[model samples]
Target: MRAVRLSVVTAAATAAALAAVTGCTEKSDASGGDDRVVKVTATDSKCEVSKTKFPAGHIQIDVENKGSKVTEVYLLFPDDRIVTERENIGPGTKQKVTAEVKEGDYRIACKPGMKGKGIRQDVTATGSGKVAKRDPRLDAAVASYREYAQEQADETLPKAKVFAQAVKDGDIEAAKKAYADSRIGWERTEPVAESFGDIDPKVDLREDGLEEGQDLEKDWTGWHRLERSLWQDKKLTDRDSELADQLITDLTDWQKRVGKAEITPTSMANGAKELLDEVATGKVTGEEERYSHTDLVDFKANVEGAEKSYELLKPVASENDAALTKELDTQFAALNTLLDKYREDKTSYVFTSYDKVGKADRKELSDAVNALAEPLSKLAAAVVK
Candidate 1:
């Protein structure tokens, strides 16, 4: 695990899956050439967004982290609905995000160290905004994605229970087998799971990701903690058994709350990119499932999630930007094909452990993820166009 990690999430808005959000079309002043581009300067303690008041359409957030620690920038609706966000902006690096917005009041938040409620700024999208003429296919994509999210949430609770029961029974080998199996749905729909803000940290947080003020012995709990007790410590504690029940309880909450999540087409496209980002930052590096070395399982799930998002929006994207769609198709196929090489168990969702992967193979996997992510980044722009 990296000592300094900035790649985490805090929800902006509701606690569920896909949002059919309200957005503005073209309501900003045409005379203000390029003024819609928001330049965000981030520091360890402060975040500044240039031209907080701008016209709304396809707005671009250009972020440069000048802080000593890694930070993140967000564009949020007044209700805390996430319009779009770019996380893991390491100190001294820059990242850009393009999102669709309606003319409305929004908040610009910067979280330095990726911790707590961030510095906030009020921004307004000025105009008598009209509903942008969006493709019907995009709307259809949103609907289909919502169904998919619900399906994952529905399937997860049962699998998680089996894993939890095994743990409670002190069935080490069964628990280990059921462990990675239980997380496939979660890793597949993580962006939706993360929309609830605190849920991800509660269920999936690794020890290395504990809050600065949290005590490891007391504050840290999740799949990773359980994995440590099972595989690393090689013994189960009473606390670990209790944690197993809590895991199911938390996921049960997630299952019931899935439909409550907000969904938008741009959010889906951006979520696809975020899934790839998770792979690059965590799973690809083998930090996510360190104790169990089941990183490949999560890695494949992340890729599948990203691919699902891309596939849903492909029809609209093909019409608006066929070239991008083609490249995405190629890259996605290549990545999946590459990942298939590691599947030793055809009967189940098992793969070679991440720890068993070599440096060259890992680099190859990283390259494949980046290759797909590049085209995936342009998806929101294409669909919104």
Candidate 2:
């Protein structure tokens, strides 16, 4: 009887110990597990998100496009600053974007057409790290650039109005002049301007993106479309005037929207290099202004835009590495000098005379742009360091 009692007591004590160990294992697993995954589906006009609450840390989202339209999923802050994004998701497909976020509120916006104010879903993240502190210098630089964008935006409105009025009145020569002149402001701020939903594409998309079976008579608009009417078709129709009015309205809206934009040093440097690339790919090849042959005007304007971006970030880059800054300055000056030879005046360049330019001259100009682009590429890294 004594042996039986002892055996039963021992068995009960072992069972209790095992239960305590199991409870601790469960607690540890809960504390250090995988990040919460959010599933999202995008349709024509709506965004459906699986989860609206998360624990702050590294989060992953699998965005499936269940719609007919091409879409982009963006994780934006309250101010519309993109935290991370997955772009160019085609129909019947899926892509993913992962970001390490602190405890705060975030917005998940899905742009179906890749243009327009998209459907947004709000999420609340709970964690120890909340709203990470930003570098003051970087913040100041972004603010300065935002102010510059506003100035450019204000500059574009009146000029764009004049250009539209010329098209409305059927004054071809005046309209052409205004078109080239007005584009300067738009080109200067193109990088930031492009973030403003549907308006940017309407204001500046190239002809290569036109839909299948879509043509001038069916679904073309904006600067390139007008460029075709004025130069290729040789007549600015009533439709052209209507499109012009729409462009003006869009630009006004863009001006307001850009006020909420966020800028970073990396983006600014990348914008500079991107403008040079535009010169190389389109302007140099004469593909951009196929109808008007106004490639030189755009080339000059692209250089101006690139120069502005480079100048804005030059201080930070120079502090990091003066040698790189010096090299970039020299390369930029060389490119500018080449562009100056084609200028007709302070605000204009001879777009028609591009055909007359010899092969050697074009090669020299192209080489100078390429030279600038190389050193300019490193500026972004320097600014980050």
Candidate 3:
């Protein structure tokens, strides 16, 4: 539960370094002329819309939250893939989202309180519109993120191997350090890792998912399980190293799959939003890394991944809306400053002693993360526009 001091020098240097690395332009918020705007009214538990059918193309939904609680609306594919989503729309505030859809059945989800399953309505697009031309800028952006995803996966394998070896050699101190180092690359490419069947769960599943009747002895597997052994129990046995071996094996396969993985502009944006959500929901609460208390590592990695996603799409997004790009860049720098406060070394942040950390310090980080999430959530629709 050690706390690392935030030096004024580090903060100034990080801000100065990243400011030059990412560039942005200035622009205004403009609506597309081709958008078929639909009016959507969201209540506490229901979503009412003007129509459920449209021609296949880009359609805009002007959503007004008239409920007591905050609400979010999502356009989802039949396979449950989210097309586009808007979050943190407070009561009485109107938010607009434009989704590029094809001829198919989809679900319109309006989530009240911004959690759990929302009320759903089936929406269909029948007639085919003229094929929209692909933007070369967005295509290049997708290619960039795809390459980054591969780089992250490749970076993870050797670290996993080192972690496994440390555990096998029964060096608890070395294993503890290796454990945090191992998670960085995984956290960066977590969304893509999730696409590789059950490998993600098998490699990174937390102990909280233990079945109704199962205990740690039964279902607890992957990184957290090993974490509990090393930090809580303060021991690494032969059985623990066996789990580490399996982790390396799984990641090796994931690396190959990531190389062939299909990454589009939509996926990149969704991945960025999801990464921030990971911090807000799990890491901020200290539920993730419950044993090691190294949630900062995951938080920093999530921000890194999200920023990389924005960087990939910046080319096209900046072309259409530079204001949003500039806002995101500023927010990212702010969040990075907040995270760098706990720098343990060149590549790691010391674990936050959750029990020892003050409420004000915790809230400061949480507020900074939410601030960044506000701009990140709009990245997809912004780029697509």
Q: Among these predicted structures, which one has the highest lDDT?
A: 1
Instruction: List ranges where model 2 is wrong by over 4 Å.
Output: 1-134, 213-218, 345-352
lDDT of each: 0.75, 0.66, 0.68
TM-score, each model? 0.87, 0.66, 0.73
Candidate 2, pairs of clashing residues:
none
Which stretches of model 1 miss by more than 4 angstroms?
Answer: 1-32, 77-81, 90-93, 103-105, 113-116, 345-347
Q: How accurate is candidate 1 locally (lDDT)?
A: 0.75
Per-residue alpha-carbon lDDT of candidate 3 for residues 12-109, written as tens digits (9 for 90 to 100)? 10101000000011221223343355568999978998888876666667788999998878776655444556666789888776555567787788
Candidate 1 vs 3: which has more TM-score: 1
- Cα lDDT tens digits, model 1, 9-49, are 44433633222221222333122356757888999987888
Worst 10-residue lDDT window, candidate 2: 15-24
How much is 99 displaced in model 2, in angstroms?
9.9
For every model in order, what is the number of clashing pairs?
A: 14, 0, 0
TM-score of 2: 0.66
